[model samples]
Target: MGNSKKVILLGNFGVGKTSLVRQYVFRKFSDDYMTTIGVRIDKKMVAVNGQEVSMIIWDVAGESTHQKIPNSYKLGAHGIIYVIDVLRPSTYLSIEKEISSLEDLLPNVPIVKVANKIDLLTEKERIEIVNNLPLNDYVLCSAKNGSNVEDAFNKLAESLI
Candidate 1:
């Protein structure tokens, strides 16, 4: 086993951070939307370039006017997975702000943009959003159906290596 990598899943409320983690970790899905009150951690083993890597994921509570991402939780992250809901344009716009805040706290770590709920968007909408975003690497994922979930995780791991 190689060194375990620390990663974080961050986004606004109801953007499906828990759902994404649940799908990736257990290959399961639920229709409910429950806000995460605090940080939740999960571990998974993945192989990158023939080397075994353990991913320690920290799914932080969604950002809110009353609650912000805890400063203590942002320390020592190897990378961050910033998730946005495709059906909510506001969530997309907030990505920059989230990245900016996170960068201020954990500067120099890699960040992977994820457009979640792809299953809810039309083809044209997806193209339009993807084309305009500045992300060099992004994924249209559906945690509900387990689509591209692993790919998103693998891309982050590969970038770390």
Candidate 2:
């Protein structure tokens, strides 16, 4: 239960990376938007298969491209949660490229591809967007509404074990 794993949150700016972290760790959401300059770290213990796993979540500052992120922020990562705002096409248009870069940087590290802000989309909109994105597998989450936030993190935690 004392096992700790490093997890990184990678995505473009304003894709709700911090919001997802806050929602998962603190169960709180704020309306104000603040840019993460470098990186923010938060710790949450998740019960993965009845065992507590300490997730050291690194909310790195969002960059337009994965190549722009500092290597220091990505090293030693056990997993990554790549989040995308469902309402913002720009956030996910280059997902295929970004994910490929991520794989090259951290080979064998599991990434939980997430589509955040699903609460803002209707069922039809969700289906349409999912069909349009270049994604193999992804989880729909809404940080503002606390929907599937835990599941996304837990899935990553389980993979770490």
Candidate 3:
């Protein structure tokens, strides 16, 4: 065991924040859409630079605007996993605004932008979506099929160290 870091998942409703946390921490995914009322916490150990780092994940309930999230939930976070659904442009249309709000709350916190539910899209579609997204760097993941899920968390863990 090694030092632990606090990480948070933030995004709009139904963008798969809970699903990503479930997959990363438990290696399981479900189609059921259980709305998170407040926040769900989970822990996972990841090896980064040959050192074990415990990742404390706070899966906060999604809000239309990041500003609406409870300030208490945003504090003490070492990293942020900002997720969006590839099928919903509306979810990410205000990406700059959302990210800006996060930055305001947690300045200098490392953020891993993620596009979840990639399993629902074709390979070409995935590439196109990534290209069109405003983010220069992000992970394309599928909680349902377990693609790039580990890599995403590993990247965040690495940054924490």
**lDDT for each residue of candidate 2 in 44-137, tens digit (9 for 90 to 100):** 9878888878899999999888789989889999999999988888999899888888899899999999999989888998899888877778
Each model's TM-score?
Answer: 0.88, 0.95, 0.94
Clashing pairs in 3: none
Number of colliding residue pairs in each model: 0, 0, 0
Where does model 3 exceed 4 Å of error?
A: none
Q: Which of 2 and 3 is ahead in TM-score?
A: 2
The CA-based lDDT of model 1 is what? Answer: 0.83
Superposed on all Cα atoms, model 1 deviates from the true structure by an RMSD in Å of: 2.3
Per TM-score, the best of the predicted structures is 2
| Per-residue C-alpha lDDT of model 1 across residues 87-111, encoded as one tens digit per residue | 7777767566667777877788988
Ranking by lDDT: 2, 3, 1
Better of 1 and 2 by lDDT: 2
By TM-score, highest first, what's the ranking?
A: 2, 3, 1
User: In model 2, how many backbone clashes occur?
Assistant: 0
Candidate 1 residue-wise lDDT at 159: 82
Off by over 4 Å in 1: 64-67, 129-136
Pairs clashing within candidate 1: none
Cα misplacement distance, residue 100 of candidate 2 (Å) = 1.2
